[model samples]
Target: MAASCGRRRGRFAGGGGGPMMASIYSMVALVLVLVACVELGDAAAAVDVYRLIQYDLAGSPFGSRLASLNHHAGAFPFAPGADLSRTAVIIPVRELDLSFLRDYITNSKPLGGLLLLLPQKISEKIGQVRNILAEVEHLLLHANIPYPVYFAYEDDKVEALLMDIRRSDIAGQPATATTGGFKLVVSSSEPKKVTSPTISNIQGWLLGSKGEGDANQLPTIAIVANYDTFGAAPALSMGSDSNGSGVVSLLEIARLFSHLYSNPNTRGKYNLLFGLTSGGPYNFNGTNKSFSDVAKEMGVTLGIKHKKINVSNSRVAWEHEQFSRFRVTAATLSELSAPTELLESAGGLHDTGKLVDEKAIYRSVKLVAESLARHIYGHQGRNIDIFADNSNLAVNPHYISSWLNLLSRTPRVAPFLSKNDPFIAALQKELSEHTVEVHVQHEVLDGIFTFYDSTKARLNVYQVAGVTFDLLFLLVLGSYLIILFSLLVITTRGLDDLINIFRRPPSRKSKAV
Candidate 1:
């Protein structure tokens, strides 16, 4: 009997008498297995996210760019180009302090060309502005950047700059005058408003065609570029890194795409609009109206929506560092969310590198436009449309018009044909009658945005990247197994003790008798 007990002990310890120690070792091994499985699952999840990004960027002009991007996967590498046109009436509102731009140019290579849309109050400074602009341009010319530095004088500078251009008798007079000339003046007398008159005047000046028929019929794309402010109102108001960085990124992106679409290497198949908006009393005002107006036009436009992420904590430094060093890669409108999960598990635009430059936004826009155009039109000739949601600036065309009053002071309100009460009701009714399809991609952190196309009747749900649904599932399963296994070990140990007692020598039984 004693020998039997010893044999049982030997079974537990493998030719040793330390059965209890062996049981403890088994518990530790189980723990180690749990950790190993979790780590393995995590490694698998990271790999999946990488493949997903690659899959999303497979075809299009961006695909060519993607190879370079992939090589610098953890860095933000810039593509060479800017988007400006000879026939296009470019306008920029300099509301922020120009210190950032000035420093950007002085410290780094100056921006080759820019068409600034300045208010009338700053008209007197045209000479000073021109001198500074000239210096920037002169430097770029010296650098032989290949792209010409173009300028559009606005406000009083429009007439003033026109006189200067006409007097200078430059070689590229027509190209310079039309592209650089202030085509429309925001009549000094007009009230600040995005009024119909303003919209009409600016549209008439820039577009030269009237009605929906004349609007850029080519596939249209819109970008809703704005500052992603944190929850704090003051922070948003200050346009801190979130606001300033965000807007700069948008502008850079717009400039880049504008250049590409007009490039000789590229054929302009789509008409793209970059709406730099104001964040007013309301959230997302600029983009909302921009979207509404496009939908009302009944023209198909691809929409690329992007904003700054609230830098809530210092951890964002990593993202900033990554962004600064050019570790950040772009995604099409479809791929943006998915990567948010896989790369940055926190799922917000925190940069561990350098701050995301405005250039990144431009690159992203270019990529998205190229991809969508290719997807919709392919080799065949088809129009493309894109719409970007800006801030409330879209809603208050009047405010926008007032702001641009220095330029064409036309009261401009790009009203939402979609948000109009009557229109919404009509559309809702129309939608009920027709087979409209809606696609929604629910992100783990960010709320979902749905895409609806009545004409196609197709919908797809998108999941943002970086989110570990698979990893999450494995974690749950692995946890459950570990708990169950531990409990079973404890129960078996207890059972073995009972059996050993029963098999003990007969002395105890004889005493009981």
Candidate 2:
């Protein structure tokens, strides 16, 4: 049977292959090519990495400017006078050295890149180290880093790779072109300027009872909250509390008031305006001021400070400044004693749902809703509970929490958000449900701040070998070759002939052993 099969194969090969045979061979070759491609892809692991915020604030560069990196991996305790200009340092947040980092960045040290590894559950650890992380975040966000700086949350796969890299680093065998260590590669296009960044401001009106007069003629009470957040990493800036709680409070107030206006008996005489504004980090800020009095009555002291708008300062610090510009009365209600720094608390690395208290937002809703009800009914400073806990129109903690969580997960950076972004759409839809009318106004931000693209990237980590490793490998290979060659000489000739090669030619003056 073997002879017959061999004859058949030989005959088939000897003869011109048939169409079927050619098709089979072609398919096999294609599959082999696909397998080779698959192997190449498997060699590198991709990790989701968020790039440091990149933008030009009035032509002054801030954040990381570069967006691409291809360099060998490195860690702490680098050799003295080591050239890190070609090495991408991988520093875990657990081992973050703030002073060293600040010094390096402040001095504008040359570097291939920077990769900050955050814990998988950074939200869980932030509360304990808020101050430390805030300093790091504030420093990074405010500086103009020339090199690409990326942040990635650590996972099991990346942790394992990091361990290998640490071992290589400790062994004094950093991976180079010829060495075996990890190499981070992020292939991305050059970031381009965002053309005419626009922000959407959503507004709604809860029509008051029209008693023999035009409804538009009635006095309107506007409740506004800035919905956008700014931070070190635009992709992670979920402003849960800075303004999310305020935004949710406005929505909740709208809902409670909508119920009152739905019935003629309980309708207020004044119109209610709900505004979800953007660009809160800028001077065009959003205020939850109307909720302060009610909040104060409920054991929450909300201060409504009066900051004079300086038209010549060029920096708009408060959201109420815009209202002031139009000669309108407005106040920002905040729990903070003072104004936050440029990008502080507007949302950044540490502002997740974990830090936000849903009950706090719930309280804000009650404060605003009940206060407005009292003011309309001429019951100011009274103990009447318009939205009592057990009433059908009571404040909804679940509603506040759901909206808070949604905002906590959504990135609301105004420059990156579309005028009709789904988040904005959701806001519009919710307002339309609770108010008589809703409108979305899109405004192009003046050329004060220009933003760039490529907020996030996938870093491809590849294992590479070191120059020292290559040298050691060549030495072993050479030794093996010599032994194999010597064995060949012995088999072909004699043992003495192989031995003579290593014994060295006997000197004429001395007898060889």
Candidate 3:
């Protein structure tokens, strides 16, 4: 068969072919074809999935937040129904490597989702980490794979980011008095009324804090985006935890609830509002005066009370030593803690729920809201809760402390200092004051992928069966070339041997005959 086939192709001299040679060549070709198919099948089965991590100034709060489905997915593949899929449990962070993600994906085997973390700026400390994450994401998309993603953060940390840097510096300066700093000089031509206020006339002077917002504006707050910049303060910043993170958490919860309120499936029974405050390198000045200013405006415009308003400072220490030497007094602590507890009690969640200082503030805010809801609904109102959902509370305590030191040392690089020329003296002063506080800080933010339910989205693998003719043709051509080469060598050697026999043995053969 092989000889006939080779003859048809003019690959050999077509004459002295035998059945055995034909069978050998046929078997050789079949084995080669089978080997090629097996190799191709193995290659196809070795497909890969990539994991991506993203980070911004703060950790990726959005990435760390696990979806409801995540819990379900995590509870899979175990006899006890414990999903035990640690892969989906560990949120993707922006500074992880492809190998790490690959292993995680393999172990968990998720039902197609994607986790998007905040974008981390390329810096010397983490450029390589960021690149690896990017490459993994690229590869996964290339392979047409999907996965779920989430992010998380605490609110108080964001509050620190939004602190009024100008005020902070001025307050810390030796030239200040009474912990006093720059004061706002409000200039207005409107006359102030002593008691009886006139209608449609600007006459109110708000010296106290009270609800100034409209009754209809859904109460909302901003949450910090999870990033490395949040958490504990830098050494230079006096190791103060910024309350901006707290504010951020509040905002996010409000935003999320607002989203829920708008959803057709879960809408109504709640009103939500949100506001984005300042964060990042410049300092917390942006959001520092936002609430107060808003309240003042409301009091002036509407006949509302604005009194006893204390903007929760994210710098409030949560630790015993920090608190012992902190500016807050025991009486103030009592007041703060009491209100927080009251709100918690009002929310009807529990009194034993414990968290860090900023997280406590977040809980307090939610509790306050819940309390108000109960007050409006005969003390048996439904639960209306919120959280500083994005927190590195899951991280190691020592790491948190070091991060606090870094923030303290971050230098007043904003409103008070020029971007081109840092306030070297001020920075030097902060560093020198906290020289012993410097430590390595690692901020871990969660990365996320989501497989949302309903008709909103869907994921399924669609495969088309067809022949890979090009590869097949290439393999066949190469096999044929190899066989043809072997045949040429064999035929050449045979011809040479035949000629030699005919020329040298002619006399012996004639004698024998």
Candidate 4:
């Protein structure tokens, strides 16, 4: 009887194990199948989106420079076969300026559009480039010229093509001679009106005093930088020089202050204001706005209420320290002038001492920098001090559209701030030490970028052919659900059987014994 009971128990166990094993195997198979199907579906649905952008490979002297300019312009120059009546004149950057623009508008024939070719060399004199572009835009607005002005960077291949066209059209006539007709004409009408300029000001502050001080009453130390930049032509007006270094430095300084002043327990006595102003190329428009806002918040009129704020006054004068391009000195200006002379002499052109008045331009830049600095720190009055690095002065003549590309090939030329610059070292020291007094004898200068000639483009599209949903995905899901249900049923039945086996009133024979 014992042996018979043992055999019955074994048979029951085997019966239960068979369905359990089948269910486990079925679940594993379903999961594997589902994973495989999902992956396959994902692969099938994936698509690659590509855009066909034409580049002036042969026309551009430097491949990257032209590519960058084209990217900024949003489109390539009009093709040769394009309608000339609807096209505009292409002016080289060298020919663009206040005087040249005035002459062109007054003397040149009616035009449909204008394309200015910016030179890559303008990257050296970014501030002057911006100023020139701004001056150009101002002239156009004043004259009420409605034609659309576009800017392109100078390219060798494009220039060659243009020369060939001119040669063919003139047919043995001197290249310098003009037919006296309209150089460019288009069907488009004048623009209706000029839109208002948009200037954005970014500001933040850290409380340094221990008590909850009235922000308006506290003496403020403002650290500022310009965030906007521009190039000469619309295509080359990338203000990387102004926006990249100056703004980056301001942000770093702000971050350090934030970390230091964040603790309420150890706050300093003075309030720290960080201002990152935009519209740098537009006569420091952003900075001007910032000053106005600061005045309003501090409850004091900038020039009226306070000629200079004293520590005893309820509204103490605000101290401003601005970070900008290095100041240009007399020696540097001379060095910059030497290059132009050397270039003209190299081209077999006589040095007329009038190639370009480098001294006058440098002086103008210096004056502008000084005036802007004074305006920013005017509140400080007699107490104001401006410090900067003359060696790293912002001087990029090729910032506009011109034929010259001065960068060396072996070691590509670029605008860079040295790690060991004394100005940088001094600024860093002041920030790290949190010193209230900083002394440097150098003058402060601001760099500007042109926004008038810049362009923007958007590339967003979908490839409809690649999107798909397959039956295999559904099949795999269905199989998974079915396997899951089967496992649930198997588990329930196994538990019930085990419980019944244990609950079955002890066999009558065993009970009787």
Q: lDDT per prediction?
A: 0.30, 0.80, 0.29, 0.37
Least accurate 10 contiguous residues by lDDT in model 2: 14-23
Using lDDT as the yardstick, the better of models 2 and 3 is 2
lDDT of 2 by residue, 368-477 (tens): 67777888877877788889997899988888888888988899999999876899999999999998668899988767788998999988987755577668856975
lDDT of each residue in 1-513, candidate 1, tens digit only:
999999888777642334455467667867877797565433111110000011111121100001111100100111234222222222233332345334434454433223333333333444454344333332322232211112222445344443443443343323233232222211112112112210000000011122345545654444433322211011101222333333333343443343334444453444544433322112233231122233233333545455444434212222222232342432223223323311111111121112233344443344343343444234323233432335311122232222222212111111211223342233233222211121111111111111111110111111122225446756976887666545554455555554564586779879899
- lDDT-wise, the better of 1 and 4 is 4
Candidate 4 Cα lDDT to native: 0.37
The lowest-lDDT stretch of 10 consecutive residues in candidate 3 is: 197-206
Cα lDDT tens digits, model 3, 1-513, are 998887766634433343356556767877887897666544111111212221222322211112222221111112223223322232224434465457545454444233222322323324454355335434332232233343222134212321332234334431122232222111112211122211110011101112355434533221221111221111112112333233233333343343333335543322322222222321221220122222232232212222232234432222121222443221111123323210011111011111124444444344433332343223333332222234321112343334333433343212122222233233223322322222221211112211111111111111112235556667877888667645653564455544554576558868999
Compared with the true structure, what per-residue lDDT tens digits does model 4 show for residues 1-513? 999999999878887777677678777877887787565434211111111111121232110111111111111233434333333355555555556457556554344445555554654555566456555544442343334454444566446534543554455321111321112212222222112334445466665564565756766656565544333222232333233334434544444345445666535566766565543433334452123333343343433221222333322111121122222111111112222210011111011111334333333333333333444335333323222224333333332112011111111001111234442443445344433333222211222211121122211111111112235546767787766655554565565654564585788899899
Model 2 ranges with Cα > 4 A deviation:
1-42, 77-80, 285-296, 311-314, 468-513
> Once model 3 is optimally superposed onto the true structure by TM-score, how far is the C-alpha of residue 115 displaced, in angstroms?
7.2
Write down the lDDT that model 2 would get.
0.80
